[model samples]
Target: MATEATEIEITTIGRRTGEGHSHPVWFIREGKSTFLLPVGGRGSQWFRNLRNNPTIKLGATSAKAKLITDQAKVGQVMDEFSSKYGAADVQRYYPGVDVAVEVRDS
Candidate 1:
C-alpha cells in the first residue's frame, strides 16, 4: 500500500498464447520485499494468467521481469498489503470468494 502513484507496472503472461501483457498496478512494498494483490482475485484475467504460469515481469520505475508464483506466501503478503492498502480493500477483493495472494520479486 506504500505507493507514490508512480505507476507500478507488472507484466503477466497469457495462459494460452505465451504472450506478455503489462498492467499498471499499485505495487506495494513491505520490509525488504514487494507484493501485488490482485484486487479481482483468481477470476481476474491477470490472476488467472498468473495461475497458468507463475513467471511474469514485475517493474516499478525500473523493470525486472522475473518468474513469480503463488506458493503459500499469502499471509505475509496479505499483512503488508492490508497494512497499507487497508484490510477492507484486500478483503473486499472477491468477498466471500477466498482470494489468492502472491509475492513478486522487485
Candidate 2:
C-alpha cells in the first residue's frame, strides 16, 4: 500500500500564492492518521503553507492537516519516526524538530 512506502507526496495550497504546491515527504501511518515532520521545523515553506490552510492532499487522498506544537506530543511522534526510520537518520535529516503535522484519513 502507499502508506508502506518510504515517502508520500503531499500537496498544500500556497500561503501567499493560493496555488497548489506538492512535495514528497516522509511520513508514518498510525491507525487512521498520518504524521509528517518538517525538515526545517516550522520554518519549512510547506509547513508555513499549512498554517495558512490546513487542508492537504496525501497522494490521491484528501485530508485535514493539524499542526502539533505541544512538545510532549511532538516527542511522541518523533519517537515513532525514529523507530521507523532509525534514530540517526531522523536526527540527521530533521534537525529542528519543533513541530509536526498530523493528517487524518478523509
What are the TM-scores, per candidate, against the unseen true structure? 0.60, 0.95
Worst 10 residues of 2 by lDDT: 1-10
Model 2 lDDT, full chain set = 0.92
Off by over 4 Å in 2: none
Residue-wise lDDT of candidate 1 within 1-106, one digit each (tens)?
Answer: 3464534677878998888888876556656555666666557788788777766666533333222344455556666666766788767752533344345344
RMSD of each: 4.3, 1.0
The worst-scoring run of ten residues by lDDT in candidate 1 lies at 60-69
Off by over 4 Å in 1: 1-7, 60-79, 86-97, 104-106
In model 1, the number of clashes is 0
